[model samples]
Target: MLWLDVTHRPGQAPWVRLMGRYLLPPCKQRWHTCAAFLPQGGLLVCGDRRGSLLLFPCSSSPGWAVESAGIADGGTSPVSEDTGSGSEPSCLSHKGALPLEAPLSVLFGLHGKMGVTSVTCHEGYIYSTGRDGSFHQLRLQGQQLEVLRKHRPCKGLQWIEELRFTPDGDLLVLGFHADNFVVWSSRTGENLHCIPCGGGHRSWSYCSNASAEAFAFVKCGDVMLYHREAEPCEQRVLLESLHGREIACVRRLGAVEVPGHTTLNIFVTGSEDTTACVLALSERSRAAMPLTRLSDHISSVRALALASPVGVFGLLEAARKLVLVAESFHHQRCVLKVEAFLHTWAGGERHLLCSAATDGSIAFWDITSPITDATDALHRAEGEIQPLGGCSCQRLCSASRGRPRWWLLCSLPPSTTFFHVPDLAELDCWEVAEAGGELRYYCVLCGRGLEMLHGIAPPESPLLGAPQ
Candidate 1:
């Protein structure tokens, strides 16, 4: 296998010519079947058809990141040297420039049964479905993966083509080759709903609407939209339709919210028809509304993901005066929907929203802009900002030129970088203050605080926007 290292500047797409490639060791079984980026860091995990899982550290791997205070000679370009070959993820900085083929470490030797078809990561756990009809969960402990548990094999469940975890983490949905989808509990192996209809169950995505009531997926070449009558239970599909061609991908985009007008759900889909289509969904009894079509790509558009617009957007939406507070994801062990939360201390109270996890993990976050009020406790708190062990949100990072983020004080063993934060249910508040360029945070729940950074300059921080 070959890897291309290209430098892309803003506003420019990168182009790498595929000159040639090298062959790997002869394997009679299937080659690399699937690859995934680990949530913990930059480790790349790939599973071959022969049941062998390999881990590629990549030139941009996070190994060099943790060990070094700064990127040592980390720059743009490819230089070379031959250290021969061994099994371990390789980074470009360690080898000077770049290597045509970097050795990959073995994540799993060989499954006695079969190979993996679908792989996904949530929090610190990795879930994979194998050809042998098994759903396996692995936990990342340091650089190694410890097998946590695997679902009991179903007698005739063949070819799990796709897997998705609901935002609540209560459901583990599996799409099969036989044009049907099944839901199961992520923690327990109890089988739940089995909905069989439409096509493209082989390629499907689960996206929740603003109310978190509906989800849409593609089966065969058709789209099916379902509404949850109960919280994560009892679903009724409001609409279903067949596209003219194979539905390649469907993703839910942020919908426009109206005060009195019926809010229309919006989603975009790409197809083998070489066209991207937009459709509208209504909460009331009706069919999916077709919006417009654009034939941009020459070939099938394979994937669709949501991202913040790079250029100006939300300008008109901003005029609507939406005060953005915080973002959210699922934290299962803690029973909280979020794993960790962060904000500039200058933000006022309710500027912070916190809930506890069962594992003693807590996240406090203020989603919107800072409102100055000296009487506010959160406004006085500064500097001692850090995230917990199992934080899957944006990580605390540093660079030679960019600013450095502070570390969260953790009670878990020093070796543990991530924690499940399974211990939260009540309000755990904190306050911040800065003295002589150093920031300190006081935990109202634990009656403790840690001093964060010492030389934090004015431009390096915004929490100090108003000087005490």
Candidate 2:
């Protein structure tokens, strides 16, 4: 095994240094497959093809790292070149690296001939599993590894692949049997659940929170989610066919508060299938149920923008169609009823609204003023700003600095531009105070993963600000 030292600088990329190398025990059938580092530092546990767990002491006192630099050409060096240059190699080793350090202990035949597949250390005990359909626990005693317990295969679980423990300390074993993925619990030594997923070769994940446990796996080309609540409940597929095609964007609309019921959040999703879907997410059930699906777009629905207070939303399509939707919360039905909408921006004034149309025109309106019908409101774009180079604005956000400023996202060329609207009628504080307070940091979602940006406050920012 090769040991490496990695170092990172303040503003530059990290660099690695070669530390030391050690040789593993020789095996005829198979070699090391999985490994785990013990909770206590300087000790590594490796599982090999012969169903044995080997412990290697990587501490500095072992002389592997301490004397690695002074290891001369031949002074008790772990590596030795073969005098018979034509002889076949027995074990792999570094030519000029430090001599091999024998393992502190090796526990053999723990998983029989199936070979160890995974090794993990929890608390202070070592746990290993193999295709032999069982997992064994071992403890380090002096220089030897003693087998403490063996958990045999649960019914229907024939070949074990891996195991993990829940936050509550219940052991969860994952494996396959009869072409189905099975989860077995060590607390009861029984099958917790089974999902027919063809075989164990596919990708899968299992997670548990205080109230529920979730398992997701890929079957064929579709993803399946399974949920189990801490309290006994019937299982069901909460969402069916969320979209006709791949989803492109998702945005939270708002939250609904109802007495004695789960707090539900409203979310809107745009899809490549030329549709937008409204969903109600229930925290208690851990399910997202579709409330409505808007299928009026001619092309793919690529982006969505929402103005929650007035229930106005905008859906941007691949084609030049910007559809406006207005929805109202129906408490009795626990649903939102759509009225009419496009891309809406409520400025510093709540009554005065602005929207960007597909034809690249900006329209302003006094929503609180009298309107005979929806048709009147749609046609009455009181003060229309001329089209800007035929580029439709897909999104709009209003910011305030004594007067209202609008941020617009343009389509076709896909650019962001801000406008200082000084003459727009009646400004009500469209910009709401920050809900909790000024943010200390913010997160940006990127292709790789979420990135956190810290130091949100400027060097001269105040320690306290106006409360929400």
Best by TM-score: 2
The weakest ten consecutive residues by lDDT in model 2 span 443-452
Estimate TM-scores for all models: 0.34, 0.39
Model 1 CA deviation exceeding 4 Å by range: 2-25, 39-42, 61-97, 100-104, 107-114, 140-145, 153-156, 161-171, 187-192, 197-201, 209-468
Model 2 CA lDDT for position 366: 52
Q: For candidate 1, what is the TM-score?
A: 0.34
Candidate 2 residue lDDT tens string, 1-468: 655554544443333444445556777765777887777777788888888788887754321222122123433423233434333231223325455567888777677876888888888888888887777878888767888866654534557888888877678888889888788865444577777778776778877777898878898889998888888658674435666456666666766988999767677777666667778867577577778666446567766654323344332233333334443322222222223323445643234455443334444555442323333544543433112112233333333332223332332122222333322222211121235775332211111111112222223213222110
Off by over 4 Å in 2: 5-11, 60-95, 216-468
Model 1: weakest 10-residue lDDT segment is: 443-452
Residue-wise lDDT of candidate 1 within 143-229, one digit each (tens)?
666677655323345555446666665545464435555555433434555566543324555544435545467655677776665
